[model samples]
Target: MTTLQNEPAACAHAELAQLRIRVIALENLVISLLADTSERQLAIARDMATYISPRPGFTPHRPTVHAAAQIIHLVGRARHFRPMAPSRRSR
Candidate 1:
């Protein structure tokens, strides 16, 4: 072919090559972003799971002395009350 024809063809080929390279780079960038998003989601899921999991031990609702006194008082009150008649126990 003549130089004029060859020049245009070469320019078109170069442009097509550059476009292919850009498209490949864009695809790689998109894939990388998706992977990053997936990693972030997994980390969030793990954090939420940890947050929702039950703890190992119990917690007191009141101070130690007050709670102990309340328990003793209730037990003493229970002992003072009697439900059965004397005859039932004698039988």
Candidate 2:
């Protein structure tokens, strides 16, 4: 394949790795949130909405809500356990 053709694959691999890291982070956040998933989701939704549809006042410049949802979904599907949350906790 030509260099031009190979460029897409390299870019995809880099993108995938970046996405994986993001997914892992999201999963950990979710697990920490635990049964409070709704609160966690609402927070993410608010942040994302502010980013995508900035208000008349000061607003965030983050990605859209859809993007956040996608990341959450990927995390749920890809990993069984969160990386940061200690597997064994002390009393």
Candidate 3:
């Protein structure tokens, strides 16, 4: 009876120890994967700076067909047709 009791405890201890080792190994693997990802991000950022142009004027709108449509909409919204003057009030 004593041997049987000790057998179960030993089995539980061994199983717990194995689980701990596996958890530690998995933690190390995740850390290594994160480090690799960081290195990759740095490489991609360098590539972007090397390839992308940086000489456009400081305009809020992108130089696209969408910007043209937006400009037309703005002009249509203005009540007066003056380029740099406001309309006089008819009191």
Candidate 4:
């Protein structure tokens, strides 16, 4: 007679256990998803860094001081040869 009266309480306990199992499964799924997202974000960051970074073996072109001076001299010579306009007449 007591077992028959406790039968409804036992069913309620079983339902509660099932709900707990489902919640644990959902938590596991969320953790896995977060880990995957973190990995993908790291990969994308590395790819973007590769695109923006200069190559290891690249050597930039730098003009020597002598070459720069030569260019300046040439420009000066051209300026010296340019025709000068007549001086402005005073009013």
Q: Write the per-residue lDDT of candidate 3 for residues 1-91, one digit (tens) a residue.
A: 6998899899999999999999778655544443444445545534543344333573433454454443333333331332332454554
TM-score of each: 0.40, 0.37, 0.40, 0.38
lDDT of 1 by residue, 66-89 (tens): 545443443334333434457767
lDDT at position 31, candidate 1: 42
Report residue 50 deviation for candidate 4 (angstroms).
34
Residue-by-residue lDDT tens digits, candidate 4, 49-71: 44544456875234433444433
Ranked by TM-score, the better of candidates 2 and 3 is 3
TM-score of 4: 0.38
Candidate 2, residues 1-91, lDDT tens digits: the string is: 9999999999999999999999889766755554344546745644654455545775545554456555555445434443344666554
Candidate 1's TM-score reads: 0.40
Model 2, residue 29: what's the lDDT?
74
Clashing pairs counted in every model: 0, 0, 0, 0
The lDDT of each candidate is 0.54, 0.60, 0.51, 0.54
lDDT ranking of the models = 2, 1, 4, 3
Worst 10 residues of 2 by lDDT: 75-84
Candidate 1: segments with Cα more than 4 A from true spot: 38-91
Query: How many pairs in model 1 have backbone atoms within 3 A of each other, for residues 3 or more apart or on separate chains, i.e. clashes?
Result: 0
Superior by lDDT: candidate 1 or candidate 4: 1
Candidate 2 local lDDT, residue 20: 100
Clashing pairs in 1: none
Residue 42 lDDT in model 2? Answer: 47
Model 1 CA lDDT for position 81? 42
